[model samples]
Target: MTTQNLLVELFVEELPPKALQKLGNAFANVLFDQLKVRGLTAADSVVTFFASPRRLAAHVTNVLERAADKDVLVKLMPVAVAIKDGKPTDALRKKLANEGRAHLADLWPNAVDGPDSLVVQSDGKADAVYLRGIAIGGTLQVGLEFALNEAIAKLPIPKVMSYQLETDCELPGWTSVNFVRPAHGLVALHGSTVVAVKALGLTAGNSTQGHRFEAVVSPVVLQDADSYAATLRKDGAVIASFAERKAEIARQLAAAAAKVGNGARPIEDEALLDEVTALVERPNVVICQFEEQFLGVPQECLILTMKANQKYFPLLDAAGKLTNKFLVVSNISPEDTIFVTGGNERVVRPRLADAKFFFDQDRKKTLASRVEGLGKVVYHNKLGTQGERVERVRAIAKAIASQLGDAQLVQDADLAAQLAKTDLVTDMVGEFPELQGIMGGYYALNDGLGETVANAIEDHYKPRFAGDALPRNTAGVVVALADKLETLVGMFGIGNLPTGDRDPFALRRHALGVIRMLVEKDLPLDLNALLAGAVPAFGDKITDASAQLADFIYDRLAGSLREQGYSAQEVDAVLALRPQRLALVEKQLAAVRAFAALPESPALAAANKRVGNILKKAEVEGPVDAHVNPELLQEKAEQDLFAALQRFVPEANAQFDAGDYTASLQTLAVLRAPVDAFFDDVMVNAEQLDVRMNRLGLLKMLHNAMNRVADLSRLAV
Candidate 1:
């Protein structure tokens, strides 16, 4: 088969910078996939995607001009109905007519279907008619058109813009189309030939416009698919590849920042980089500076304003401190670039001024005064105001602090919890909700609060997302855990548990945050006791969801353990005990893993499982005292197992009490021999009632001793 590389391009008005990367990738991948599906591409076809402010394009190698013809099999009705009297019957005629094959009925058997007659017997009665013939393959023109339409229709466009264009016909009138931008041109080329395709009211061609102001030619003509990139770069004065353009920008930014000296570097943000790359065709990095006094505002505020509003990269010093200088990526290069730098500097002054104003205005009123304002702010319709939520959080925090420390710690946590959400009502936080907890800490310092209280206020929202740091102090940890638990318990109490991906309350994150603090902090605080303490803080307004919330937390913990690379069996075995101290879970899992690797592990696990099943079936009345009367042991196996238990159980229990879980579990490996012998030789359900009960009591004692760290039966498999 003859093959050639394919080229496609869509010229449009400037696209949304944030969504441009995803749109370009989707367009290229979908076009290549659709072409491959139509057999117009080979298995090894390679695709390259191009995205810029004004264009989305793709180049695919190993695409075919026309797909090779393939044999297709068509099944028809039973042979008995079609081969009547050895001539075509009415039923066959109708079937052939419906398929547009009526004229070929005389040659039906001769058309294809090997030497075997079209008739095939089935069940000695019904026979299905078969037709096998070559199918005409698709051409580049047809396949390209289908692929083009599919790719455009499936673009991950954040928002669509509608425009009108004239129809390419005599009865011309404007037709409206909705796309990410108003597409003005399209190009589809196979080798050096233009493929016949139309999109957005334009026919495919081999030429497309380049950089709006720098193109040497009005329309850059591509010679072939392989020449697209070179042609655009040379004649078009534009880097057509997104990756190349981004790299060029990064290089220029680094060079420009180095020229600024003082060990200055551009603040690295990939999302900002991608957006800036999408906003320019030929990047020219320009250094711009503002007045130093604007740095009085928080660096986060200035940095966010520059990156979010102006699409600029703020320069940072070696100490990781923000400077007044920033880098701007421009689309044009001029001999004297003073105007571009001056213009960006002038434009950013007001944005920085507004941030400074918000910061100054926010500090004038201390956080203590802002507490009353939160009462007016609604946290949730079902959960009352942020003021009420703060009270609940304060109670939970103080209770947790009291459990962990002295009076001073409790006081610090109570104060921090009370002030944490007050920032949500502050001017700066109102402008940028991301600064809620941060601004609270700042305001607390200005109010002359102790460092511990201010720090706790800010750190209360720690571990907000995956991989984020936890609270830095004990008071902070207490307040943070309380705040998260308050949200979880309140929402769950009102039957607002998360369903699928609709966790509007972020219950999952709150649960994980609680788990992280308890485990990572190793606070010795009981999770159930904490939850129980939290439930009553609601004070009868919400139903009790303590049990349900505990289960939910355990489920999240199980998933978190699996994601951390623990096997399902290992996780199940450890979690089955439902150990209250989450900090011990990892240790328990480690212990179980070590125990399972012992030579006698399999037999012990199986024996533990069997013992559990027998005890469950017996459903013995009351707690069966594991104390066995030595005289009742009628078999040697039973007597031997009893002797082993008496000797080992105390040692294992001592180790467990001493927190030597690994050593404790490993010690039980010695019991496998005696346990197996007892199970193999003794009938747990013996006819003699006393003997059966004694055996059950013995197994019960064994089950209790073996499962202190984890449920050994879970490792049976």
Candidate 2:
């Protein structure tokens, strides 16, 4: 029950702040799980994980003394170590020499002098067997560096390097994992003892130094982890929690900005805040003023310039108009305000001026005129030009627009998709790649394009992350789906499917984007047919990769549906037909979900639980031709179910044909009561082969009705 506080510090040559943060967190998580699995428990364990440019550290407190007591331990020895009849061999004789316990080796002391260290000696026979009474060490430290390396490699840390030595590499990006990022170094410790931790070009050690600016060479010391962190804060001045650092920055910024002009608005940029927090240790908020002339530039362009180039937050007045002031988060203390403020202001001025020039340049030429120039710009070496992609998108848009049944949405698809990539060629987008879609939409709107076209330009890149927002406009959905689908189809056709997590073209994302559009937008999209046509229209350029490409998209469908909380079985059932129609697949998936939630539970699906009896027997009897012969319907349950089918079929068929799948499913749910009663009250095997086959035929008819909606039997209610 004895408790311990543990600290591990890894000092490297300036780790990127993001990587440091990830490493810190990964170490904390890996150690927590590792201890738990080993039955290490404590009253409490609080771990503070933090990182700086040069160090990664975790401070763990109230940890159990050691891993829980082990019930068993077995050590494997080579056949050369075991003599005939399971006696200790001469090798054991020599090993006993060190311990001064060689009673059994007295007869063979001279025979063990050979230095072969053989896995199996030249005995006439050799055997591998478990030693009955092998015993070993009492406890282990569970090298912290080993655990940290594993977890860090899994984190989304970029700029991983590759050391030339094979043994030095902790991870194998060159050998083929998911990504290309390389690992640097790891520092593992148990309490305060150093441990080895090398895997993919990384080596583990005990010593870690502090930040270069303040606690430069005061080797961060800890009797255990808790005390180690206290030393860091006291000496290094590191704000370990990025969120904590960010909040501190915000509070200071608000107070500073209020001093300039009370009741002013604070520009929120959660992303920019995080990035800025990474670059600093102690933060000071600075509010600086710029000339009013810069306000004449497009606010978005100016904002992007300020945030991206200079890492400054814009200030706004009560009316939401851009103010002359900007708030800068400084890394140094208040005494260094003059130096930091001047430096940031100097950097931002040129960016705003460049944006002003670009805005003026873009005003002279419309995005509409530039749309044709996209043809000359290369989209891909194999896929021809960006202009050609626009053409494919046009074809895709036309196809989708016909389904939309709107003239405006249809015509805007061509213009929107064409202009969607035009921003990729813009000076603004070139300066800030993240603004590609935003800038295009702005330009299209300024050039007098319709709202649909402008929105389509933006939404084509919507839902960029998991569970993010998606395009709401119909034209936007078409262009967005087309853009992603074309990339997926093209890469898939090139036999470049994502395997073992390696997707150079982000095919996974492209497919997920398509899934979101089809499901959320409620677009009736046949993904396979759509993607198949997408690559071929580029002049039969992607012939062999079509099948591979379809599979890639389907794999993404499984991922996206799972992300939405759909079970694997339901996904498989809907995808059973390789459903070209995403709407159809999702409809079936939803139907299965509903069936699962029913009160009677399985309803007809309960029959599947006895598949060995019902399905096996029915398949042997073959398909039930539901052409009612009336005389076959002798039982009351049977007659009622048959009549129910008759009543439900016309409506179900009409609903199914009209694409009212949910209504059709509700119509099928009517059979559940009669189905349960029939199974309970009547026996299908009636001591006559004709009767049994006839009943089987009836059951098959009901099953067929369920299939038209979705394979309800797949639902495990």
Candidate 3:
């Protein structure tokens, strides 16, 4: 086996910064998958990736030396059937006769072969000859290129523009392969040598740039890929890794802040650091301070302006208050200057001043007064307006909250919901869309709304993504559930439900958010019952969508519980009980498992199985109200069994009332001994008509008692 090192580089014109990380990740995974799929297994390996605004790189160490030479007996379905008894069929005969091969039996007769062996396949299974024809040997290079190109075609990108039209390019640049952004050239190398890349509309070359502003125009020579990266850094670029860049930014921010009297503390924003890292080759950090007057503006507005507009990092005091100073990380070297510090401050000052104006203007009106403005703002085209959506949410929340025992919070949540969307009309939120909910809470509080109302405004949007924080208070939980339920019911009603991978409305997300609230919050709300409550709120607006809405919510519950390690079948079994309370379902599941594990479980199930089989066959007439005549109960064991049934019934009901299914199951277990004794001592189908009917009635009672915890027939343990 000969192992050859390979490198593929795409040195492109400014690619979209966002696409850099995704594209690099996609390439490594796809390439690794494609190569390994060819039956070549790596002994051990590690893969690391690098990307910047204009470049993407991947390095793999100790990969498979070469693809294993694949050869196996290729099986075909019914290989002999193809030959039709000992001879080929007419079509097969003609082909074989043309080749002068005669019947395959003639070459080595099946009836008269020396070793008494012939390969015959059943009609349902494969045969060797046919499978052999399609088994092309697994070769590394040809297959790798094909796999790489297929994946590259599917990579997601934005702002694609292309040139260099090729007549036969798989996707010609002008109409075919558009880069995430425009491309200048490509460089793919194996160790120190250039490999094929233009088939991908990329040139395989030894040359690449160090930095757009710093390096010379002539192509920089590289002895090896690793040296190429080292040279680029020496020439002025910090292109090692994303993690390295992020760490460097943090290091500089901390050092610079320490020089100040109170020093600086890093605010956590790995995402922000990542984006700035892409825009530069080498990183340099500068600290600047805004006027103290700017702190009067909402901290979110300050954050939005710095992170979004200027790509600057905001500083915070140890108390978590926003300080006037912010950090601006530049990609250029210090000598390049490039107006790096001054230019950033120029952009931030105007944004800061605009925010201050909105803050002052919003305080002029109370939040209650602004609730009327939501009517003018459309929430959905068919749904009337934001105010209308809030009306529906308020009704739904109040109804759900009343059941959950948070009636007081419900009222406050309703008030919060009433005014939640009004802030979208605010100048602050209008200019900074991400600030919608956050600013609403701020403005509502400033307008003299109570803490509960302000919190509900913000909490309603809690858990913006999976694993994100849920609402911290009961009022927040109430409003959040109401808001998501409204969205889900509305979307399904409109026939705009998520299908396949498309969920433009993010219905699944909303359902997940709702599920998390009910379960983790222990809201004492059953999803099914809560869903039923929400239906009246949707009113005639969404009658047909009700079943679809319920199913979607249950599916989300299945996913959420499955993540917690419950199997789909177990969840299905518990849900089959039609639990109206989530807490009850959880309790029942715990009880059932404890009961199911008992030694008595299989035996009771056996008795119930016998009862079900007999009841099914006899078609026992008219709920046989046969009273056992003790004189007719000629068998002593029969009399003994009656005594046991009398004892079991009362305690069973008591256990169920106490919600002690484990004890209920234990109570049922008591009947097993009597059932076994009666079956052993006497035949149930006695000769006397009244005696047989009485016996069957007794068995029927046992079956009814066992069905209470779960369908025991399902437990055929």
Per-model tally of clashing residue pairs: 0, 16, 6
User: Could you tell which candidate, 2 or 3, scores higher by TM-score?
Assistant: 3
Clashes of 3: 6
Please give the TM-score that candidate 2 achieves against the real structure: 0.75
RMSD of 2: 7.7
| Model number with the top TM-score | 1
Residue 654 lDDT in candidate 1: 97
RMSD each, Å: 2.4, 7.7, 5.5
Runs with alpha carbons beyond 4 Å of true place in candidate 3: 37-46, 62-148, 158-160, 165-177, 215-218, 225-231, 246-264, 335-339, 401-411, 468-472, 492-496, 524-529, 544-548, 602-656, 659-717
Write one digit per residue (lDDT tens) for candidate 1, span 351-406: 99999999999888888888899899888888899899999999999899999999
Cα TM-score per model: 0.95, 0.75, 0.80
- lDDT for model 3: 0.70
Give the whole-model CA lDDT for all candidates, comma-separated.
0.89, 0.67, 0.70
What residue runs in model 1 are displaced by over 4 Å at the alpha carbon?
Answer: 78-93, 103-127, 620-627
How far out, in Å, is residue 400 in model 1?
0.8
Q: Pick the winner on lDDT between candidates 1 and 2.
A: 1
Candidate order (TM-score): 1, 3, 2
TM-score for candidate 1, residues paired by index: 0.95
For residues 159-259, could you state the per-residue lDDT of candidate 3 as single tens digits? 55655545555764454665565555566555666655454555567777767676644466666655656765665354646556667777887886676
Worst 10 residues of 1 by lDDT: 111-120
Worst 10 residues of 3 by lDDT: 128-137
